[model samples]
Target: MKNKSLTFRIFINTFLVGTLIYFVCAFMFFGNLYTYFEEQLFNELESESIFLEDYVLNGDLLKLQNLETKNRITLIHSNGSVYFDNTVSFEEMENHALRSEFLGAKDKGVSKVSRYSSTMTEKTLYFAKLLSNGDVLRISCNQHSVWVLVLGMSQILLLILVIAVIISGISASWISQKIVHPLNSINLDEPESSDVYEELKPFTKRIAEENFEKAQREEIRAQYTANVSHELKTPLTSISGFAEILMQGGTDPKITVDFSKSIYDEAQRMTTLVNDIIKLSKLDEKSIAMEKEALSLRSICREVMEVLSASAKTKNLSLNLEGDSGLINGVEPVIYEMIYNLVDNAIKYNKIDGSVNIKIQEIQNFAGDRNKVILSVSDTGIGIPYSERERIFERFYRIDKSRSRSLGGTGLGLSIVKHASKYHNASMLVTSEEGKGSTFTVVFEI
Candidate 1:
């Protein structure tokens, strides 16, 4: 799980940082080793020069020669002559008196290191401290011992840093895998309860919620379409029926007038049904959203009455808006249709002196999340049969088929109301008894 691509990058990065820091620190630290060797050589030269001070002051050549062979030393005189040269002759060298060791002996009063000879590749440490007889000591070696030891240790440390980089890279792979593996399976469509990393829990919950909402929306849309199509068939059938009758017309004036009136009525019914269908479809598809502009429900009721009052007067029925109006979030066209259908149905099926009372009020619903604007149209008319009240919203369903046909009903009015409420995300409830008339309530959510 941990050995993922992300780990590889982490390992490489760590290795690089570690290696660079080590190199800088090691170089500075190892420099002290070289300095230590230089100090050792200089101290040895000082000791030898002091030992020879007593011997050289007495002009003891034999004692100096014995000491020089043991210490790898050489002696140079004040005039630049090699009296006892164990490493190289002074005159054979390149201007030893002009070199650092010679200058230190004369001026700085301390030891100095200088190159002795190219063939030997030796480094010499010179101590110019005066002997009792005034001679100098020069000790020389190749520094081969210090170089070999330090280089071997450096190689070991380099090997360790390389190993560290490798180990860290392996660990990095593990951590990267832990993060990215879960994300890669994001679109797997697994259930929320399925095994998943803790980090991905919120995402899984959201996906499930979206899927649930999608399914619910599709179900609602299907029901609305089926209901709308069923209702339109009544008017469509009427139009088709009359058109066939006209095609077979015999020349009876009374029959001609009656058939012509029927055809004209069916055609208008089909037109109304189609227009309402289109309007509801747009609302359902979300192409039309409710406009929140403030408008008086009471005023709209009067306007609806003005448009419909003549038809009511034809049957001597009274239509009135009985309650104070309220503002609602809805497109004007939808509200018009909603109110129109309820009142139209009432009037179409009412008695000679039937009355429709339009009552508007604000009420809180079950969820208490929103305030609903309700429009109730109650009629005193020939009411729905108790057994058929539920079927009224179904398309083309009419309780009194003969009477409804005579009144030029399209059978699509109630269905339009049902779909319109659904499109608005509202609800509709119907109540009626055989002789007590009906009330259709339109509940609109804000």
Candidate 2:
């Protein structure tokens, strides 16, 4: 049933329900039929008894033979002597003194008894009454036993059941088709446009929303592809132009050397851009092998600062690391890369003599009073506007495109930081006021 299709399951369910209903109706009909037959049997006995007693009082005992074909009429004397018998000779007739119906009639004026015959295949119903001549009048009728009666009707019941099964199967197939046709006809690409059952409206709307989102993602990918081509072409064109100049034989040796140098610089920029793009692709595919170990957050931050100190010095920015030691479980290189990008961006965007503060501290949980770790970088740089903050983490996005290009910074640095933070199950919080300073905080729940 777990692997069965919906149509088959629906068919089975409908058939089962129909079968139950059929049995219930059959039981009720059989009950009423049995009751009606029993009542008719009793009425026949009563009418035969009344007719025989009336005939005997009129002194027409010879007419008793007329009723022999319908029922057995017996005459018994008060002293238990068999006076007249219709089905047998008077000598062979059994004594009626000890018979249930006879004894009952003598005491109660009228009585009836039903008993199985000697062969057990037949039953006889006897009705007896006290007549005006002080004689007991008895009428007996033979019929099939109750078990035989049930067996006789079994053939008819089996036929009805077979017909019911055919009808139920047909109905089940028709109903299952009616239920499954609309689902099969639904257009997945534009689900809401299809007219289906009212019960399926919610599912169709959900599919529509997912398709819309998928379309938007495809459009974004197209734009990103165009951006990557444009970004790569600029440097490649510059390098090609300079190489062409060198190849054509420059008039001065110094000028030729300058051209070679310019070509090298453009080539390096293109190489960096291509490498960053590869890294972004790897991150998107989640292909990086990660090993978790307990790491000192403060030490990683210090190492990032040391590597970027020369860049910070050139910018005339004061780089500082302050806070307590905090331990976290993460991939060491990924954490270092995350911190390096943040500090590098701080120095690149800061004004001369601006301060870049690194804070590593343990955060206390408000609900459970548990201790967690946080690493924050605060920079007195040209901060981002509120509108651009959300898009800043998107690949190839920039607040100041020209300035970002001039700084020799790949737009993927912040994107890498975001991916790395997410890999460690960390949350990034940003606070910035344009023309003031920005603080980027990475909270780790280790």
Candidate 3:
């Protein structure tokens, strides 16, 4: 019971207050009734006195002499000696001096009230008046009627208060539910705003804000996971391929020499993959501080193509730059790595004699506040499937696992391209489809 809810407590308090209020009303009502009963007793005593006086004035003494038996009337002599007993002899009982009405009536013939007096066996009220003949007429009546009336009224009041409290408790609980129900149903993780109570507006707004912040954090985490997997898979692929090559040692003498030479190629590929992945990881973690330098964007692209030209020739793909661009503020190696990855992926995945097209153009972005450098790499090869266009950049994700492994392609290439672009405040985008070819685009802030 002590563990009950706040609303339950409120209801209980309301009910108790209602019960108290009901009892207070009952007490006041009974108090008024008791006063009325006192008044009626006084009136009855006065009326009886008047009747007795009239009978005496008309000189009829014996007419209601036996009335003392029914009304508890006692006639006393002038000498303070009782002349009639009715129930007992005067000598057998104590003097009624403690009664106020007895003294008042004895001294002044006045009708008066009494102190509560009791017999050896019964409790009773005592009333008295003095006679003109120097005698005292006293009366005592049972208090049974008053006590019964009070007790019966109290019982009824108790019953009514109990019922009222139960009803009030139920109503209070219902009111509590009306306020708490809506709060229990709200979802704090989704991205939506809905109307709630005005008093609860602050809480609702806080929930919405937290949900939005949480969504942003989750998005960042997902991007990191995608970026990291691709980053790691690239180096692992080169290392594994080269290790496999070195294991088939000393075959045909020509084959043995060729395999040994090829090991160097694989090792360098692994080295490039590792360094790029680390750089991207640092950038993704925002732990790398880039020192921007002035360099021509066109010259950077051409230099990167020259380094990758031999790989393109081996794959029988044509790699060329189509436009010239002025100097851009960026770190040279970082820019070289970004362009190289994009150009390399294009050639590596191209069909025999496929062409890798590099284009650089200045364009206006939606913000309309600055010139943008758009670097696009388009290739003619096995194009991306429409469904896999967006997923191609995730780490370790390969459309054709066996073919990618055979080609010694590290799945992290495009992922590094993505992170490198982001590190340089660039926007990377892709357009592709199955059996046609693919184009990768980067928008660099200029």
lDDT of 3: 0.71
lDDT, candidate 3, 61-128, per-residue tens: 56646565455666565555565555666577655554566667777776555444343232355566
- Itemize residue pairs with steric clashes in candidate 2: none
Residue-wise C-alpha lDDT for candidate 2, range 1-446, written one tens digit per residue:
58478899899999999988999998788668765766677678878788789888887878886665568888898877888888788878878899888998999998878888887788888888888888999888887876677678999988988999989999999999899998999999999999988999999999999999999999989988998999899988988888877788844899888888888887888898998787667667776677889999898888888889999998788888888788999988788878988998888888888989999898777788556798899999999999989899988888889999888866888998899899888999999988788999999996
Instruction: Give the true-structure RMSD of model 3.
Output: 13.2
Worst 10 residues of 1 by lDDT: 116-125
Q: Model 1 Cα RMSD, Å?
A: 10.5
The model with the greater TM-score, 2 or 3, is 2
Best-first order by TM-score: 2, 1, 3
The per-model lDDT (C-alpha) reads 0.70, 0.86, 0.71
Residue-level lDDT tens digits of model 1 in 277-323: 67656655675556646666677777888888988998899887876
Q: What is the lDDT of residue 432 in candidate 3?
A: 83
Q: Which segments of model 1 are wrong by more than 4 Å?
A: 1-158, 186-194, 198-202, 223-245, 248-256, 285-292, 311-316, 323-331, 348-352, 360-376, 381-446
Top model by TM-score, which number? Answer: 2
Task: Report RMSD for candidate 2.
Answer: 3.7
C-alpha lDDT of candidate 2 relative to the true structure: 0.86
